[model samples]
Target: MFRNVEIALASLYVTTTGVLIAGIYYVHQILGVEQWGIIAFLSLIMTLVVGGILAKIAITPLREHFHHLERFSKETLHELNLPINTITANVQMLRKSHTDEKSLKRLERIEIAAEMLKERYNELDYMIKKQSEREKIEHFDLREVIEERLVFLRSLYPSVTWDVMIASYVVNCDRIGLGKVIDNLIENGVKYSPKNPIITITLQDNTVSIKDQGIGMDEITLMHIYDRYYQSDSTMAGYGIGLNLVKRYCDRYGIALHISSRINEGTCVKLEFKKKGIVDG
Candidate 1:
């Protein structure tokens, strides 16, 4: 589609320039030097008007396509809320009534699944709001958010070992965005690791680090880690958008992000908050 648009645009430019050149030559020969300036001005104005119309016409379809996608995303997210809420509410009621170990375990799994769905919904909503520039920044406890995300992730990946040593540090930023960033880093560590992955997380002095014993990337892979949809290992089951989103959020919030890895050893990611928005508690 983009190639077609490029072709159309190229053709439009060539045709417009050819016409302008021919018009100028004719005016120069027939109208003499005195009137040439006025003719040239008129020709330039005509070219601009024609070019603007052609460009708008060529771009209208692409614009409408994105508009439809955005609208569809909003509507789908709105529809998802009802089912997620229903599942969560019903699970809560069941948990209150059931006391048997087997039944409670089943209920817990259901509750976890529902919570995961809710998290996904929140992630999608956050992305939409972020693209639209509607996300608001506010002060929130960094430790609290990381702990909350870890709780959910631990439930999902029970085999993975978590070593956390987080301090109470408050920072002003998009709370949901920050949560997404943490979730992505931790999840990546889990996803890329072996049978029993060990993830180490620590926070101190407004800086946080997440280190993982995973199949680490080489230097070339690390260089392209932030590229959207680029995956180092094709066997991995992910669309490769995690690190890209993390990079964007960090850059936007003035957070310093550093990632280092050694192949077969592991990967470590660090985020340092700017002093202006950080408050040690």
Candidate 2:
């Protein structure tokens, strides 16, 4: 700390001395008392070069400081994932084995929240690490992937209705990442929605959207929907980082992401692709 202060003070002194010397030299030249400004120019330029180098050197530590903070968050979430997975699994087992209907229902809600938290942990890990930028540009069938997960998601809810428009659509993307985006969007719809709510998904051209008639979020939460590290206090447990990573992934691939919502009405997430992707007819 003291060292930085000393360096800063020295830089200030150098700046002041250079400015004073140049001003005096200019005055001397104007009064015909001096014929040489060569030394003054060189000194001024030297001061600039040295100050720039020193300032850059100071920024290195600040960069490392932020890196350390992100790494610490990753480590913390990694530890949290273990207990969360265990708790969710045990809740499932208990639901099947135990006969208490009310308790079992409560456990189911806890399990869902736990699983959501686990997914958020996964997102944090990917976002903090140096992820590959070339992963989402490959060509593949997106509708097939959606169909593959459809049965599982349907069984999990057994109430909310989903209307998928595309029977078989192909797109350019990293299958794993895009699959997660779809899963999270579906999960969000199911989590916040009332029982038997209607969830609609449409894929046309190069765009896909998941719209849910759930208790939608307000304007404030919608604005911070993609915040890196956020938490919601409305009986839902999430690290609030999933959509942020999805937005990041899409943006890197030149995809446009749009979200809209009205309180007590519904929320819509629209993803528009810009690559060699085709939607099912």
Give the number of the best model, judged by TM-score: 1
Question: Mind sharing the TM-score for model 1?
Answer: 0.85
lDDT of 2 by residue, 27-75 (tens): 5665555545755565567667766766666666666767788778867
Residue runs of model 1 more than 4 Å from their true location after superposition: 1-11, 22-26, 34-41, 278-281
Worst 10 residues of 1 by lDDT: 272-281
TM-score of each: 0.85, 0.60
Q: Score candidate 2 by lDDT.
A: 0.73
Clashing pairs in 2: none
lDDT of 1: 0.88
The digit string of per-residue lDDT tens for model 1 on 58-140 reads: 79768887888899999999999999999989988998889899999999899889988999999999989888889877888
Any residue pairs clashing in model 1, and if so which?
none
List candidate 2 stretches off by more than 4 Å: 1-45, 92-107, 130-140, 144-159, 174-195, 213-249, 256-269, 278-281
lDDT for 180 (candidate 2): 76
